[model samples]
Target: MEKVKRKIIKIDEDLCTGCGKCVSPCAEGAIEIIDGKAKVRREQLCDGAGFCLGVCPTGALTLEERETVPFDEHAVHEHKKTLADKPEYNITMKCHLCGTTEHDRPLLPIKAKGESDWVCVKCIPRLIHG
Candidate 1:
């Protein structure tokens, strides 16, 4: 019988800058940055590859052995889809005018609120004058 290894990923929320440096490295998409902190959303996606832990510059991520339910690849993919629909707390964009923080790209001329401008909401004022 093949021995199934238990895996657990621990992230130091205090050390995490919410940079999301670990997200892409994880093939399973087990880790996500929520509210500016790295969190292991599901153990099923983690193959214990130590990819995320190694990529963390602040040493915020560490993998430890622990008792966990068996890893499920299917469930992991499903979980990743659910995460995609949820708002990303780490999403950040630069304002073209004031150079302040903007969360995401503009919706490309959505008609909401009688908005006809294509610029991001933060840059709308500058666009009107320019």
Candidate 2:
């Protein structure tokens, strides 16, 4: 396959708080939180659809034009299958604040706040300070 200049998702590690808000929005399973940083596992899995952009509170993700490998739907399917086969992938919980279900653990347990609800990492500040 010939390389092409296309839009791709870029994550600035310095800006990413590993809130994990971008992961669930990426239907291709491209973005993942590794070592408390959001990373794109595979460039081919990103479709440049910008679905994960709006949810990033820290502005860590951006679409950039670059000459690189093109998006591959087949690869995305395979990646998703690999992820689905993992035991950890089966563990999912819903965020009480946003009602978004996620495979990862909730960043904050709000039991100390007199509420037995879990808040997603991205919404932690709002739930704590607001």
- Candidate whose lDDT is highest: 2
The TM-score that candidate 1 achieves is 0.55
Give all TM-scores, in the order shown. Answer: 0.55, 0.65
Counted clashes in each candidate structure: 0, 0
lDDT by residue (57-103, candidate 2, tens digit) is 77788899998789999999888887876543344557787876665
Query: Candidate 1, 51: how far from true, in Å?
Result: 0.9
Cα lDDT of candidate 2 equals: 0.76
**Local distance difference test, per candidate?**
0.63, 0.76
Give the Cα error of residue 95 in candidate 1, in Å.
Answer: 28
RMSD of each: 12.5, 7.7
- Candidate 2's C-alpha runs over 4 A off are 85-130
Candidate 1 achieves a global lDDT of 0.63
